[model samples]
Target: MNKRQILQLVILIIVILAGIRFYIYIDVLRSGGDAGVKTGIVEGFLPISALMSLKKFLLTGIYDYIHPAGLTLLIFFLIISIIFKKSFCSHICPVGFVSETLSHIGLKQRINKYLFHTLTILKYGLLAFFVYIILINLTVSAIESFLNAPYNIIADAKMLQFFTDPSRTTVIVLAVILLLTLISKNVWCRVLCPYGALFGLVSVFSPFKVKRSEENCTGCRKCTAACPNDIQVHTKSRIDTPECFGCFDCVNARNCDDCLKVTSGMNHKLLPYVIAVLLTLTVAGAMTAGLWKSTVTNQEYRRHLNVIDKLSH
Candidate 1:
């Protein structure tokens, strides 16, 4: 495995461990025991809540007390995209890691180009819908109300329950996604993830990008073939497309020296380590600021769990 893949594997393992710990923490609460473990890392999955909390924070000066870690992580990811060109998707996101792994084991079939482009719009549409609802439509008061509601307070627990006791529809939908990923590369990320779409948009302004030098061009298409996002790296002098993941697959695939280089960005060799250090610092800073954990107590979690089935948006 390459450095990027190594980083992804490490992050994926950490995420899995965090998930297990969170599950145990919630299980202890469900069993009327005080686990006293802080599993706020799972709040990374609660993006919608984080969005609402972010809006509220911008409108008012208050940070989300219930899921502070969610807001912190959302900000951290956005910043990473601004600086690193969607490296979070290729390096840190567990979903993207799973999608990448499935692509290796699966058929790796190619969809029609026209169909692929058409489906790519779906993720943008989802992102637009979310921006309309959370950023444009919701008033500060509405956001505040939602953030303070019992439904939002225990959103993390609800998310855990979702996987632990998935409905038939959830199972079917996930099965379809798994099948799709097995056949195609990054099916969810490329075609259906609003979070990735959001990052792609932000990454358009990123100073970092892939630059190709024609001086040493051998006209080989290895880089294009290596691109997981299917970006035609051989055709473009500069890859400014938001689809570029900056995972350095294309860079690593190049046979010609200096043919394709990441321009105006950290060196390809050190980018993964830089990302790792930044991630560590981000978490450490949040912890030092007392924003890495939620203010919700175990008793509150138990109380919310008792009535979570009846709660709705």
Candidate 2:
């Protein structure tokens, strides 16, 4: 009905559309693989082909960004994240953001804010574990299985097909984690998402983070209470906590504007640099997968010796 309400509605609409797109991708995969023409089967974002081909990128660090549907979207949003400090997670990450908005609305006046705040830290731990595995045991073939996953009953899945059935390990893990998110607050962004971790790292350099003019301290601690993420706002020198998701809720509060300014930290803030890194990864990753898919077709290896024999003759 007012300014805040209108802004909330706009954000809700954008986030909902993003969620619709993501959910549709999953359904298209589960629909016995017949994905109709409207499904963006050939389009870059809906194609689901890049994940399988990510093997090449994980192995050698190269990629193609023009073909697979997710490459462009991920890179595009990732770039925006560079300028905005994980704005995608706050503004567009459909599922996670939707849940956060709902929970914050109901709990704004609750007495147990600390309980929800502590619970969200779990996401950071989970995110760390995923990265540890990636750094230590990341195998291209194994990850390929997750992204391209083959279907048992359907033969038309253009997405990569691993043994015609996924291992179910990741599926179970993600399912349980999502169930936790439904019951808990911001479990994914707070703990489980590697993307969030990447943003957290870059956010350290975000010039426009919540800044407090110590001179204007009212000591109300309301900003801290208003923070859905539970950042310690009343007494922190630098508000560069890993938990800060750049949502701007604290700074936008009615009483907290002058106290907290989104000050610029650098002429070339960490935001741009992080965006560049993620974009590089997304683009390079896509290109690497595409080239591998084209050149290393299992058929090419099979024909290798046959061509060599002809050359010897």
- Candidate 1, pairs of clashing residues: none
lDDT of 1 at 121: 94
Q: Candidate 1 at 297: error in angstroms?
A: 1.4
**What would the per-residue lDDT of candidate 2 be over residues 1-313, giving only the tens digit for each residue?**
3233334456457544644553454355354443332222222333223433333455767553223444455446545656666655655454455556554544334435577566656656765665566545657666554443222101122222222244588568766755655555565666556566656665565565667888887888877766656567877755777567666666656264567777665432243345446545765665555521222222322333223323210
Top model number, lDDT: 1
Local distance difference test values of all predictions, in order: 0.86, 0.50
User: Which ten-residue region of model 2 has the weakest summed lDDT?
Assistant: 152-161
lDDT of 1 at 36: 91
lDDT for model 1 comes to 0.86
